[model samples]
Target: MKIELRDISISYGKRAVMQSISLTAMPGDVTAIVGPNGCGKTSVLRAIAGLAGYSGQLLFDGRALDRPPKKSNRSLVSYVAQDSAGRSSLTVLEVVLLGRLATLGLRVTEVDKHVVCEVLAELGILHLAQRFLVELSGGQRQLVFIAQALARNPAALLLDEPTSALDIYHQLHVLEVVRRTTQKRGLATVIVLHDLNAAIRYADQVAVLREGHMLACGKPEEIVRPDVVGPVFRVEMVSLPGAGNYPTLVATGPVHGSQGAASPT
Candidate 1:
């Protein structure tokens, strides 16, 4: 499935948070939303997931759903929140099995158990299936939640700051799984990222947002330049080639001005 957001805007009472934002996530690819804090990146994800109210068009596979998508349309998308690992007493396997609730009636059959185990195995957490959610570390819990989302078998996936609490190793590990699964399943995946380097390295396309509007959108390496990074993030970031020729973003320092402007090098 494909996701298209056209002229989208959001507000809370009288305060505006996003304006005229638009982007697209095509099946078999990863589309990332990158921006500084309070730039409406998370808000965009919520709007797409039909958890938040917004104005403008949100089309899934070329069809627009009524605002806050109906129950029928909800199953077409799976959302992984920034802090998806809630403090539940449920076991890892049970939490993951919850993803199949849309298709389950009373009990989990052998096939459902197989699917849950398969997803956990794919995420390299099958061994932890018997562990309680509250007993796992933050990274492990994050991976388990991701497994749950994948188990849903949705055509589109929305992730909000998925790597915020993860260590560097698991950060790469999770993104790698997301990219591989997105391609293998032909799923339209959209993620909100704060790390510019991760966006360039993992995403096929990147959309930059600033304040309340979209600053730019295109291929990550093409759009994540010094010009775009410096202004949107207010940091002196220079992109350099990393291992295997992947681009790496390094923040030299903060921009020195009351307005957080970058000094010309």
Candidate 2:
């Protein structure tokens, strides 16, 4: 799937969130959206997921979508949101089964079970199949939701801060799995990441947004330069010495004369 957003603008009541925001995520590639807090990163994902109404166009492989995707749609784009965890008694297996509900008959079929199991195993969470959602930690629930999304077999995967609750090991593991899956399944993967280094490591392309506007879009290395990072986040991004061929950036401190907090978008 190839997702294209053209001049999208989103607002809530009387408040505008994003304006003329455009992005493209291609199949077999990962596009990571990065910026400071409240920069409309999540809004962009919501618009592309058709969960939020926007002023402009959202296209999937040249086909326009003007409405939220129905649960019955088999080829629906999968979205793993930031606040995905819920207080529910549903076991991990049961929740994942919902992904195949559109194609499921009255009873759960072997194929559906197989697909659920496959995704759980891939996420290394097969042991969590019988665990209730409320019993798991935030990070564990995050992983479960990711498995559920994968079980849907979507052409496009939208992940909003997927690694926010995870530890260093799981963060690296999940992203590696996402990259491998994106390439192997030829799926378009768009992820919102706060960790600049992680975005650079996992994403083939990077899109930087600030105050509801897109500032840059290109290879991760090019987009994360000091010039771009410093102005957007108001940070002094410094490249360390002997950081190998690929530079590693660290925000040493706030830009000398920048403001306190970035205004909400």
Alpha carbon lDDT at 228, candidate 2? 77
Predicted structure 2, TM vs. truth: 0.90
Residue 14, model 1: Cα distance from true site in angstroms: 1.4
**Candidate 1 pairs with clashing backbones:** none
Error of 2 at 144 (Å): 1.5
Highest TM-score among the candidates is held by which one?
Answer: 1
| Residue ranges of candidate 2 with Cα displaced over 4 Å | 66-74, 135-138, 241-245, 256-265
Task: Give lDDT: candidate 1, residue 65.
Answer: 83
Cα lDDT tens digits for candidate 1, 26-66: 99999999888999988998888889899888998889987
Q: Could you say which candidate leads in lDDT?
A: 1
Weakest 10 consecutive residues of candidate 2 by summed lDDT: 256-265
Off by over 4 Å in 1: 258-265
